[model samples]
Target: MLEMSNGSQHQTMKLSKNSWILILIFIILLLFFSILFFFRSKPEYVSKVDIALGTTVKVVVSSDKDPGLIIEAILREFHRIDRKFSVTDPKSVISQINKSENPVEVDEETAFVIERSIALARATEGAFDPALGNLITLWGFDRINDSAFKPTIPSDSQIEEALEKSGYENILLENDVVILNNSVKLDLGGIVKGYAIDRGLSIAKEMDPEATGYIDAGRDIGIIGPKFGGEYWAIAVQDPRGDSGEYIDLVYLKKGAIVTSGDYERFFMMDGVRYHHILNPKTGYPIRETISTTVISPDAMDADAFSTAAFVLGSEFSAVLLPVLGGQGLFVDAQNKATYTEGWSFFKEKH
Candidate 1:
């Protein structure tokens, strides 16, 4: 009886020991998984700065990928786009198209941009024509390397001659080739930078689809996704008349692009008159209705074209036109009056 009782006790103890071991193993595995989850949930931030498209290109990425690799990739992509679309690069596709009177073959990217540019012109009723290269040069904007480069207003006759050559209808895209009429010179300055931003952002997103970041191509800005903290990025609308670093309004957006066109940035003063770069397609002179215009859209290219159109269309027309195109804008007129589209109110800063 004693032997049997001892045997029973030994077996019970062995079973209890086995249960404790299993529980310990389960706890260790739970700890390992918990640590992994914690690390994966955290965000890592990476940023890069380079000069491309004749301006500063800054990219900020938030992801778990190596920051160095992401930054390097972003910079490389910016330079590639710059080479393909640069108006001044002698070997660029754009430069070749400008020099060639016949239809010139180009890469798919260049062809797509040309098509989109033409479509935007038609959609805005010629308010955002890319064929104003001749007029832009006539106004001496092409010679501008900085504010120090003095500019002279084009003579009335000069403006007329340039306008005669300026028409979006003159550009022809047949198959994968682009043709500029002999009189027309191609300049993608107003839109190419925005397109470059879109392209660079795509590379960063491809590196990590869930990552968030912002690409600042000179004055134009495009956001990839929500911030790491899961909030919209706050972007300030530059005050057209205010000093540098001053802003008139604030915009909050989780994704997409924000671009502003203002008279203050690239204008020349002669005899107390300002001749800015935002020229009207019909008149071949600066549009004076609005001092500044801000556009928010799904991408940088559309935002850029819309901002230019909004500035030319003035406040009243832009308020109506923006909603039709599925975008938004905030326009400040010469009288300091601020007007915004219906969608603007949703992202406008509460103050």
Candidate 2:
């Protein structure tokens, strides 16, 4: 009887030991799976930041794979480049061009922009000429301060004089050297930001080819790649007369440029009407018939020029001009109607 009792006791002990071992193993597996589940649910963080440009300018950058340090370095370099090319400063390249009798030699980057400007001028039939500096200054658009609105309409004689100096043909670029007529002046403000955005994007791609990035320079924007895990960067077009932060519509872009020109952004009221900065090459007055126009193209310079050109051309002419220039445009007419190119529909969002 004692032997039988001892045998029963040993079996019970063995069964208890086996149960505890199985329980421990199950608990460990449960803990491991819980840890993995927590990690899987957590999202990968990307940096979205607002970078200041000088005291008056500001831009936003969105990146999934790029480090903040890399983005800052790129922007710093851009600002440095801007300072070097700034026409507002008397010591900048423009001053050098004005003072030099011989062709002024510029850095590769500046040379590229000047070349692009020349190409745009030829492409737009002188509609997007960079030699409008004299006219721009005459209109007081060159002033940095938003002082009391100086409403001085240029006389026909003044316009004629400015026109004489306002053609890209007056400036010559040969063998990477730029020579400007003493009367003609250069201002790349309308196109340089877009070009710089492209340059910053190129740098970002070089740093991380697989990384997705975006550059927004107030009016000009460029996308390096899609947002993380997506194939397109969704962008919103701002309403010209609406609240500052409000948008009219969203568009999806993969690899392209978008630029908008709006009269409401910068203008002065005269005799119960507003006068914007865009000057008609012919009339020497702000282009009428459109409140704003936005252009999208494979190149930023094209987009930058086309946006302004479409505004100046009006809906009737832009409808023909945009397609001919190999681009798509969105125009907001004086009646507040929105019209877009046939190609623009491909980039429209599905509600």
Candidate 3:
């Protein structure tokens, strides 16, 4: 009887070991299925595509979608449309509709930019003007590559000449046709990239309604939709110094554009002082008093234009001016103190 009892206990111990093994296997399988379900329910992702355009263009899109092919097509179309208005020799376009003579015809892309520029100029009361191209070129800010050399300050006479040649009033656009007076020259550099970013986002949205993406064109950026797991796109504000990826702060953005303009971005040092690219339309001198200005708006064009305008307007006026112009802006003075409009706080990410 003692031997039989000992054998029964051994058998029971073996049975208990097998049961535990089975339970462990079942738990592992359950966890696997849970993870699989979670991922399957989540949206698929796509790789980022870098597009080079005026200044620079880099975009990040959904992985499930082909950003490479899509960006290529969009860029091809943009150039094709831009060629009509562009003068290859001068490498610029005339974007005014004149009443005195037959208006120059522009493609859909150029026409759209002209319209946007006109609207922004009117809204800002000449704070953001495409006609500032001559002044930009004079200041050497029109170079395709960001130049590190400081341009000699233009004399008062040169500024006067540039000012005479620069004005939105010199441009005329009617029914998709644009004309420019002899003295007027158009430079869409400030607003065109933002417009293209918007266009790209529009295409991406059409392709996948749920897809989230962002476009970074040098300092101009636009975010569409939310990030994976329904998070906002975190954007880093780069430090103006040459150190790459040195971010001042990370801003959470959704379906909006953030543009920054600063004196430290592209400039050369002369005798221990830095001379940057952004020039004031009024004085034809590099804008001072503010280190940087960032503007966030529903439209990339508005954000781009306003950021530059706020920089030009200086810190004191920008605080009051941006709201009157119907936008939210942030100004960082030379001392690094940040100030923004009342609406700018809503976009800040809480730690």
lDDT of each: 0.83, 0.74, 0.71
Best by TM-score: 1
Top of the candidates by lDDT: 1
> Which of the predicted structures, 2 or 3, would earn the higher TM-score when compared with the native?
2
Off by over 4 Å in 3: 1-44, 49-51, 63-68, 74-102, 144-151
* Model 2: pairs clashing at backbone N, Cα or C within 3 Å: none
Q: What tens-digit string does per-residue lDDT give for candidate 1 at 123-202?
A: 88888888888898777776676556668887899989999998889999979888788578777777887888788778
Give the Å shift of residue 109 in candidate 3.
3.6
lDDT of 1 at 152: 80
TM-score between model 3 and native: 0.77
Q: lDDT score of model 2?
A: 0.74
Q: Where is model 2 poorest over a 10-residue stretch in terms of lDDT?
A: 51-60
Model 1 — which ten-residue stretch has the worst lDDT?
A: 1-10
The RMSD (Cα, Å) of candidate 3 is 6.3
* 1-351: candidate 2 lDDT, tens digit per residue: 112346436432234677889889999999999989887643433444443332222333344454565577667767875776666668877768756777788877678888988888787777777888888878777663446646666788988888777777888887778988757888776677677767777777777676565677774687767666366777788887788878887789877788888998667787888878787876777877889888888877678888877887787788778988888888999888888888788788633
